[model samples]
Target: MSSLQDIPVHVAAEWGNALPVLHEIRHALERLAETGEARVIDLNAMPFGPGDEDRLLGLLGQGEIEARLDALGVTQIRETAVPGVWLVDHRNADGERLVLHVEIAEVPAILRTQAEDLRDAVAALDARLATGASPFPHRPDN
Candidate 1:
């Protein structure tokens, strides 16, 4: 086996066309902060070549929270190191990436519970309680 130093490593000098996309991401973040309007940047729409995705991911980095939803397909939501910025990845049943989005917002809309859903949940709990089917059945005081 050859020494580790003998191996050749190739490093690209610059980010190429990805700089414009990064700038767009920054502007979207500002817009979200000021107007509370979320923006999504679709990577597929951009002219991204090899290694560009990895570079962008490095810049955003991983954040505190990550979630996955499996309904019609698989949806993954991950926050970046920068607050209010998220990466939403959606894949079909065949495991192909259907959408790769960089969303700038206080929270990604996909991860938020809708008002109607909350109301329905409250109504359900109230009905269960009225039916004497308490969710907490093993109460020490009772």
Candidate 2:
């Protein structure tokens, strides 16, 4: 398996734009499952209460997320855990831990609104910059 590195972490407030990236990653995981490279774990509907991982496992056996993955043509062992950098307990070729970043969650609405505002602000800033003008707001403190 491979590890994640050099991934840019930008402060994006655009949930709409971010959705495409999530969709693309999900599609890639589906493809990986098809090629037996990796499994597609459906964490989107994973329960968040106490003992969630165990709950998900139990429910999966009851054919919840498993049915969804199967319908999507994914065939591999699947489970959901906390979303973050999961460091594999097993060592790799270089005696290093294999880490995977699990980013699973719906984008917040506040972020989308902020991102649109930021986009408009940046466009205005650029126009001011092109006109050789300072775009900073004049405040009494300044």
Candidate 3:
């Protein structure tokens, strides 16, 4: 049998950035667990070697929840296989990426309704009820 030193492992000339990203995620997760503080990492701001991003994403894998929002542009939010980890993509109308964020939280902030919107919704609901319109958009399936 050949000596262990004879093994051929192809190493890249430059270090892979994927592990660093994972490290960041791991630390952020720890902070979140300890302090309930969420962290967001901007992937665009990081330097990525060839295949680094793909490797990182592959490692993250996919989870159950996905959300798509379209306003001025499109925003895609997906949960990673790791609980409390999320991937968020903000894209322009032209399908260009504006920001790519890895968010560590129970749920990504983008999914939460803002206080201003919630207050407005309260007023809107009262007005609709005052107008005697059916409050329920769809009747119960009784």
Q: RMSD to the native, candidate 3? A: 8.9
Candidate 1 structure quality by residue, lDDT tens digits, 36-108 = 8889889889777767888888888999999998966899999999888899999998778998999998888
Q: How accurate is candidate 2 locally (lDDT)?
A: 0.37
Task: Write the number of the candidate with greater lDDT, choosing between 1 and 3.
Answer: 3
Two-way lDDT contest, 2 vs 3, winner: 3
Ranked candidates (lDDT, high to low):
3, 1, 2
Give stretches of model 1 more than 4 Å off. 1-15, 126-132, 139-142
Stretches > 4 Å off in candidate 2:
1-13, 39-100, 103-142
Measured against the true structure, the TM-scores of the candidates, in listed sequence, are 0.75, 0.21, 0.81
What would the per-residue lDDT of candidate 3 be over residues 1-142, giving only the tens digit for each residue?
3786598756566457899899999999999999999999999998987678878999999999999989669999999999989999999999899999999999899899988899899898687677755758875333
lDDT of 1 at 133: 60
lDDT of each: 0.84, 0.37, 0.89
lDDT of 2 by residue, 1-142 (tens): 2344365546334234334434544665555546634332334343334344433344323311211113123223222332211111222455453322232223212123476678799897677677755545752222
What value does the lDDT take at residue 49 in candidate 2?
Answer: 40
* Clashes per candidate (backbone, < 3 Å): 0, 1, 0
Write down the RMSD of candidate 2 (Cα, Å).
20.2
- Pairs that collide in candidate 1 are none
Name the 10 consecutive residues with the lowest summed lDDT in model 1: 133-142
lDDT of 1: 0.84
